[model samples]
Target: MARQTQALARICDVISRHAQEGRAPTALPRVRLERVSALTPPAGETLGPSVSLVVQGTVRTVLCEKTSYYGAGEFVVASVGLPVTCAVTGANKVQPYLAISISLQPAIVSEMLLAAPAPRQTTVSSVAQALATGIADPDLLDVVERLTRLLDRPADAAGLQPLYERELLWRLITGKHGQTVRQIGLPDSHLSQLSHAISWIRTHYDQPFSVEELAARASMSVTSFHRHFRAITQMTPLQYQKHLRLHEARTRLLAHADDVAGVGYAVGYGSPSQFSREYRRMFGAPPRNDAAHLRETSAT
Candidate 1:
């Protein structure tokens, strides 16, 4: 326990020094450090295959109707890309929110699984959730600490980083959320199959698509596709697409606080009135009003 606490402290120190006001991509491979000094409003983001470990504060993430809160010494893993609303729930000037996120590559996971010994009977829950939270055990924290140390030694990073990453992946694969992490590397896993349709919707969010079309893309029957897609994302395909559109629209509106109708049409809403109504419903304000508020918030 002492060692784990020490490791976490070391990680917090490094992240505190390097993290920016928001997300900061680091020189280390696939690692991102985040720092937030104050509480933040919920924001939508599409989180890809990655594991994020909290080193200093707490975070709240909501996927559809499910809400998950994880604090320091805990980690969240997303086996597939998920559109989630996340906020920094615990932070202050004295104790800022800090976290490290590492992208998980399927190829490396597959290689490790193949080289690993034959499987033991699964211990995690049978029900699969694409996003999950787990307490970081001592082994996992140790591997993460070693990886973070690499940030200070760039010369050694290229040579030693892969080894550390492999070890980290191995630890996670055998940890409590192993079932969800393992699905990332399995081509035939339900998560993998769901990813195909998800990728399409994410890319062509502005385009109209039928359920049958998406089902075929995922290589599953329409009925099965609906079941699996909703199971992982906790939303129907239409709902996911709508969320993406609104999120994108919000971002665009924030960048340029003009063109409410144009932005609405650009994101695939056929009518300006419908767009305004839905935007108000989702964001609690009309498009123009929301955009202005967002811009004001950023300026301050």
Candidate 2:
């Protein structure tokens, strides 16, 4: 535990130097650092395949009815694209929220899986199935530290960063969430199959889709598709579409607060009343009120 603590402190130092107020992109590709000095509002967004390591404060992420809380020394792995609401629940000026994220590449994961040894049987149930969190073991922490340090060496980062990233993925593939990371590389895996339908939903979220249509897209029967979709995403296909719609609507409203009804219609809500109702149900406030609140918060 002492070693882990020291490693976490080192990581915090590195991130604090490089990360600005919001998400700060690093010299390395697909790696970013985040520093937040205050608690953030619950905001909805879609996360692609990636790993998020928290080095300072706690984060609350909600996927449908399931909620996960992970703090310093813990990491969250997202196996596929998921629509989620996330907030930095623990943060302050003294010890702000600090995190490092690396986007996972299926090609690299697939290569590592091919050369990796056969798996051993285990009885570890995933935390949230698709979106799972695990304690970052010593080796994982070491890899993260090494990756963060590379930010200082722009020349070496281009060459050595890939190797370190592979090692980092290896750690995850062998750690508690191995199965979650492993599924991301498997072409025929359930997660990959669901990704196709998920991709479709993301692109055509504003359009109406039937369960059978999504099922056929994923090359599964209606029953199997619905079951796996819910299991992986914690939401039915329809519900997922609704989430994507609401999130997109919120994004639009933030930019054009006065275009509440137009934004709702653009996001596929035909009636302003229905849009306001559903928007209020998902977010705590109605469309216009929520937009005004978000604008006020952003200004300050």
Candidate 3:
């Protein structure tokens, strides 16, 4: 217990320094260690395929209507593509919220699984669609500490980081989150199938497709595909598409200040009114108003 606490403290120190300087950490894969001094409310949308660890504060993340909370000594794993709203819950100047995010490589995790022997009772089967899981084990924390320490040894990172990364994956697979990790590597599992479907949708979100076609692409019957899609994402295929479309539209408007109709068309909305309605429903405001408000706030 003492060692875990000490390691967490050291992590917090590292993140605090990075946040204070507002500089990205010089590490492989570009790790972002952050320390937020004020509590923040969740808003907007962002893509997260990263693992987030909280060393000194609490955070809540919402994805597709599913909410998850994590705090000091705990971590959250996002296994698949997701749009989420995240915020710090408990932080201040004296005890800032510390976080470290490491992006996941599905290829690496899959490689490790293939090269290693399977653990007992760990079948390569799909369990849940959501990849997010809470982890709070001492062994896992120790591995994370070692991974973080690699930042100090710039010379050794090239050769040793891969080994540490594999160790981290192995720990996750053998830890409480093993079930979800297992599903990601199994090519024929339902989660993997849905993941493939999701990748397709993301690549072609501006185009429309029939449910039958998507189900066929996923290699599942229409009924089964719909059921599993909702079970994992908490939204039907159409609903998921709508979310993706609106989110991307918002990005376009914010990044370029594009006209409402143009942005709508760019993201596949045929009618301006239809796009406005969906945008209002998903973001609680019309596209133009939301974009203007965001710009105004950012400028301030």
- Highest-scoring model, lDDT: 2
**Which residue pairs show backbone clashes in model 3?**
none
Q: Compose the digit string of candidate 2's lDDT tens values, residues 1-300.
A: 999999999999989988999887787899989999988877898888999999999999888877888899998898888899888999999999999999999999999998787776754334226877878989999999999998877788988899999999999887767888888899988788888889998999989888888898899999988878887888988889989999999989989899888999899988999999998988889999998888887787
On TM-score, who's better, 1 or 2?
2
Best-matching candidate per TM-score: 2
Better of 1 and 3 by lDDT: 1
Mind giving the per-residue lDDT tens digits that candidate 3 earns over 1-300? 787788888777656655552225555664667777767634545444556688888888777777778888888776677666676788777998887777767778788788656655633234564665675677778777777877676788888878877888888777777766666667776878888788888878899999999898899999999988887677788878887888788778887665999999999999999999988876778888888877775554
Model 1 / residue 65 / CA error / Å: 1.7
User: Model 1, 80-167: lDDT tens per residue?
Assistant: 8888878899999899999999999999999889876655675333435787788888889988988998888889999999999999
Ranking by lDDT: 2, 1, 3
Where in model 3 is the C-alpha error above 4 Å?
19-26, 34-49, 90-96, 114-126, 256-258
For model 1, where is the 10-residue window of minimal lDDT? 119-128
- Candidate with the larger TM-score of 2 and 3: 2
lDDT of each: 0.87, 0.88, 0.74
What's the TM-score of every candidate structure?
A: 0.93, 0.95, 0.85
TM-score of 1: 0.93
What CA root-mean-square deviation does each model show from the true structure? 2.0, 1.8, 3.2
